[model samples]
Target chain A: MTDTTTLSVEELTQIVTRIFSQNGLSALQAEAVAAVIVAGERDACKSHGIYRIEGCLQTVRAGKVAPQAEPELIDDGSALLRVDAKGAFSPAAFAIGAPVLAQRAKDQGIAALAINSCTHFSALWPEVEALTGMGLAALAMCPSYSTVAPAGGTQPLLGTNPLAFGWPRPDHPPYVFDFATSVAARGEIELHRRAGKPIPEGWAIGPDGTPTTDPEDALAGAMLTFGGHKGSAISTMIELLAGAMIGDLTSPEALDYLGTTSLSPHHGELVIAFSPEKFAAGRGGDPFSRAELLFSAILGQGARLPSQRRFSARETSLRSGIRLSAAEMAMLNEFLAAA
Target chain B: MTDTTTLSVEELTQIVTRIFSQNGLSALQAEAVAAVIVAGERDACKSHGIYRIEGCLQTVRAGKVAPQAEPELIDDGSALLRVDAKGAFSPAAFAIGAPVLAQRAKDQGIAALAINSCTHFSALWPEVEALTGMGLAALAMCPSYSTVAPAGGTQPLLGTNPLAFGWPRPDHPPYVFDFATSVAARGEIELHRRAGKPIPEGWAIGPDGTPTTDPEDALAGAMLTFGGHKGSAISTMIELLAGAMIGDLTSPEALDYLGTTSLSPHHGELVIAFSPEKFAAGRGGDPFSRAELLFSAILGQGARLPSQRRFSARETSLRSGIRLSAAEMAMLNEFLAAA
Candidate 1:
C-alpha cells in the first residue's frame, strides 16, 4: 500500500486554483471553484473532488463549458428571478445567483431563483451553507442527465437528481442536508468497482430487472430508487421541478436528440431562501429569538445538525491537513501536468 | 372475506366532506380537505386519508385547531410573505396561502410564503396541483413531529417529513411527486399489520436495535431513514428548514413541556411558485412555449409524468367510482358516528 501524503488546505486549494487558471478559468472563478473542490476532497468526497478535475478540463477543452462565462440575469423581481448561466460552472452560478436570492429574500422575506443552462461539478453543501450563514433557510434541487430508473422500470429515465436544504442554527454550524435521490450514486458504484468489492443487493438491478452484486452489471443496468417507490416518486418530481420547470434537458429522450454537438451535462438548479424573523408572531423584536427558543426546546434531549458529519470531517482536515492516497494524488498530478 | 364496495368519486367525496363539516370544519375547507383525503384513500394511501380524521378532530375539538381561521399575512413584499395560520386547519391554510403565493408569482414572476402554526392533515399533491393548474411550477415541504431516527442512532428524533414538487406539462396533467424521507411510512407498517403480513426486513428496526419483522416493535422502536446516511441527513435538514426555520416545534426537545394542553401538531409549510412566462427568452410570446418544446423532447420516448399514476387513478375513480375496503368504510363510519 502506498503511504498517503498530507497537504495543507491552502496548498491544495492553491494548486487546484493554479491549474484551473492555467487552463481557461478566470482567476476569481478558478479560486472559488477550487476552494469547493478541495473542500470536497478534504471531506473525502473523492468523486466530486479532484477526481472530477479531469472531466471539468475535458468539458472546457471541448468548448462545451465556458470558464469565464458569467451568469446573466434574465428576470429579476422581489420574490423570484431567472438566470441564464451561459454555460458557466455551477459553483460560479451559485456564487452569483445565491446571494441575489438571499438578498431578495432578506428584503422581501422570501425569494427563489431558477438557474438554467449550467454545468454540474460540485457538492451542494457549500452553497447551501452560505445561504444559511446569512440567516436564511434554503432548499435547492438540480436535474441531470439520466442515470437512474423509475420504480419498477428497467430503463434509465431519470437522473440521480439531488435535493438539498439548509437552515441557520442559533449556536452551531448551519444545518445542511444534501443528497441525491438514488439507491447508490454512480460514483459509489465506481469506487466499489475500482476497489473490486461486491455491491450490496437491492442497490441496483441488472438489465433483466434482477438485483445484482456485481458493480459492472449494476452499471450496465440501472440504479434502483432509494426506498423503492417513495424514492422513485421523489426522483420523478425532481425531474419535473428542476428539469421541465427550469427549461433544462431532463429525460433520456430529450438528451439523446440535442443535435450534433455533444450536450455538456446541462443541469438546471432551483434555490429558495426564507427569513424566519418575518414569521415571528407577537414577538416585539428578534424574530429569531423565538426560533432560538423553539429550537432549544425541540432539541431538548440530544440532536445535531445534518451537516455535522461533514463539518467534523472538515475540522479534522483543518487540524491535521487533508490526506490523499497515492492514486488520487497521481490523478491530480496528471491533470495538472496536462494543464 | 367482505367484498370491496365501489362508490362513485362524487359519492365518496360527499361522504367525506359531510363528515368533516359535521365535525366543525367550514364547508369549503371541509370539501378541500375531503378531496385530498378521499383521493389518498382511492390511491390506496390509507395513512394520509380518512384514517387520521379522528386524530384531527381530537385536536380541533380541544380548541387547538380553529375551524375557520384564515391565514393572515404577517409580512408582505413583491416576492415573499410570511403567513400565520393562527392555529387553523392545514387545508384552510393551504387554500388561503397557495393562491396568494400563486397570484403573487404570476404578478411579479415569483412568490413564496412560509406557513406556520397549522395542524397536520392531508396529502400535499392537491395543493401542488392547485398551483400547477394556475400555470405555475410549485414545490412544498412540511416538517412534522419526530417519527424517525438519525442513522446509527436508536432514538426517534425526526418526523417522517414529506416533500412535494410539481410542474405543469404540455397537454398532460401536471407531474407531481410527494414522498416522506422514511424507509416506510408508519401507515404502511400499520397496513402490513392489519393484513397480517410481515414487514420488510431492512425497512425498520425494533426497540432492541435489531431488525424485526414485527410492525408493533418497529413502531415502538424507530423508523429507518430512507437511504441510510443520506436519508438521515435529509431528515435532519428538513427539521431545520421546515421546523426551526419556520419557528415551529421541531425535535422532541424543542416542544413545550408546560401544561397538559394537548400538544398542537404544528407543521411549517413552505411553498414556492414560479411562472415560466417570466423566464422564457421569447419576446411577448407564450411563456410556456419553451417549456413545451423541451417537454415534448423529453417525452419523445416512453417517458411519463410523475403524477400519471394518480391522474389515472383519478380518472378511474371518476369513471367507475372509487373502491373502498369494507374495513376502511367501517372506520370512516366509526369516525362519523363518534363526531
Candidate 2:
C-alpha cells in the first residue's frame, strides 16, 4: 500500500504535465491536459480527474490519439463557426474554440461553434465558467460514444452525454452547472469495481437486459438514463444536437468504427455564447447590478447558485488541502514508479 | 356524463379561440393562444393542452395576465432584441418574438431575444418547429415560480422550468424536443387528483418536507427533480440563465407578492436562432443535403429523433383524430357549455 500525500495545485499540475509529456504528448498539449485533470481533482470530481490519466496515456501511446494535432477552422463569420479537431485532445480544441466564439459574440452579440471529431473533454464547467466570468452567458453540449441506454429499453444507444450552462452573477461565482444525463457515470462504476461492491439496481443493466449489481456485468451492459423517460428524452436530444448537428458519428452504429479505442472515440461539441448586454443595454440600470438584485430576491428563502457546492468543496480543499483515498494514491504512486 | 366527440384541428382551434375571446382576450390574441393549446392537445400533451385553458382564463380574469396587451420591444439591433411582455399572453409574445429572431438570424447568421415578465407559454416545440420549418435552428428556455427543490435540498426553489431546441433536417420534420426538469409536471398532479389516484412515493413531497403520494399534498409540497441532484442542477442553471440572465425574478425571496395569483411572477425567456447557411456557406453542398446525409449516417441503426414520438402522435391524430378521455371530454364540454 502506498502512503497518501497532499500536493498543492502547482505540484499536482507539474506532476501531471510531466506524465503527459513523458507519454508522448507535446509540451503545450500536456500543459492543457494537465490543467484540466488537476482542476477536476481539485474539485473532487475524481472520475474525470487523475483517474483518467492512465487510459488517456494508453490511447496516446497506441497512436490512437494525435497529441500534436491541432484544430482547424472550417468557417468563421459574424456569429457562427465550424471547426475540425483533427484528432487532437478536446481541451486543446476547446481552448482554441471557446475564445473565438466568445469574441464573435462580443462582436456580433451572439455566436455559435461546432467542434467535430475531438477527443474527450475532461469536464465542461471550466470552459463555460471561463466565458461567463468574462461577462458572457454560455451553453455547451457534447455527444460521446454509446455507453448509456435509452430510457426504457436495455440497449446502449447513447453516451453519458453531458450538458452545461453558465450565467454571470454579481459579486459571486458565475452560476455554472455541469452534469451527465445518465443515472451514474462510468467513473462511478469504476469506483464500485474497485471496492468489490454491487451497484444498486436501476443504475445499470447487463448485456442480457437484466439489471445487475456486478460492475463487471455493467461494464458489458449499459448505464441507465438519469431520470427514466425525461432523462432519456434529453439524452436523445443531446445525441442529435451534439452529434448530428456537429456532423460527427452518433449512436451505436456510429460507434462501431469510432469506439475502437478511447483515444479515437468519436465526439462532437456545440458551444453558444451571447452577451446579456445585448438585452440589458440602455435599460437605465446596470445589467449586472439588476441581475444581482433579481437573483438576490429570488434566492430570498436561502437558495444557492448551481456551482456553490463545487465551489464550497474547492474552498475546503484550498483551506485544508485535498484528500485522496488510499487506493487513488497507490495508483498514482504506481504510475509515477513505472515512469 | 359527457358525450365524446372527434373534432378536426380547425374545429378545436375555433372553439378554443371563441372561448378565449369570450373571456376578454382580443380576437388575434385568442387565435394565437388557441393555436398553441390545440396543437398540444392534438399531439397528446394533455398537460399543456386544453387542461390548462381554464386556469389560464382564471389568470386572465384575475387581472394577473393581460388579454390584449402587446409586448413592447425593449431593445432592437441587428442581431439582438429584448421585449417586455407587459403582462401579455406568452403565445402572443412568441408570435411576435420568434419570427423576429428567426428573420434576424437569417440575415445576420444568428440572433437572440429575451422576453421578460410573460405568462406561461404552452408547448414550446410547436414554436421551435415553426422556426425549424423556416430552416433555422432554435433554442429556448423559460423560468417560472419556484416549484422544484435544488439538489440535496427539500425546499422548493425553482419552477418546473422547461427547455426546447430544434434543428432543421432534410425532407423530414424538424427535429424538436421540449422537456421539463421535474420528474412530472404540475399537470400530472392535477390528473392524479382528478382520478383520485396516489402518485408514486418520491415523486413529490408535502409542505412539511415529507414524501407524499396524495396529489393535493404534493401540490402543496414541491415536485422532486427528475434525476435527483442532476436534474435539480440543470433546473437551477435554467433559472439562472433564463431568469437571472434576463433580469427577471428567480427565487421566491425576490417576489413582491408570493403565490399563484401574482401578476408578475418573475418569469423570463431566452430564445436563440441560427442559420446553418451562415457556417456551411460555400461548402459545396446544399444545407438540407448535408443535414440529410449526416442524419442518415447517424441514424443508421433505427435511431430516432427526439420529437419522433410526438410527431407520430400528431400523425396518428391527423389520421384517426384525437381521442379525448371521458373525463377530458367532460371538461371540454363544460367549457363549451359555459361559452
In candidate 1, which residue ranges exceed 4 Å CA deviation?
A1-7, A251-264, A279-306, A323-339, B1-23, B38-53, B68-71, B194-197, B251-264, B281-309, B320-339
- TM-score, predicted candidate 2 vs. hidden true structure: 0.87
By DockQ, who's the top model here?
2
lDDT of 1 by residue, B43-145 (tens): 6565666676676777777776777776676644456656677767677777767777877887766677677777766667777888989988787777666
lDDT of each residue in A142-234, candidate 2, tens digit only: 877778777556667787878888877767877777888888888789889999999988899999867999999998888888887677767
lDDT of 2: 0.74
For model 2, the DockQ equals 0.37
lDDT of all the models against the reference?
Answer: 0.72, 0.74
**lDDT over C-alpha atoms for residue B165 of model 2:** 83
Worst 10 residues of 1 chain A by lDDT: A253-262
Strongest candidate by lDDT: 2
lDDT of 1 by residue, A1-339 (tens): 558889999999988998899898977568878988997877776667787777778778878777898777754454666677788887777777777787787776677777777777677777778898888878788776666777767666777778887777667776677888887788789889999999998888787767789999888888877877667777776666566555665656345633322344766677877776654434243545544653453355355545566788888999999888898778778767887
For candidate 2, the clash count comes to 4
- Show how many residue pairs clash in every candidate, following the order shown: 8, 4
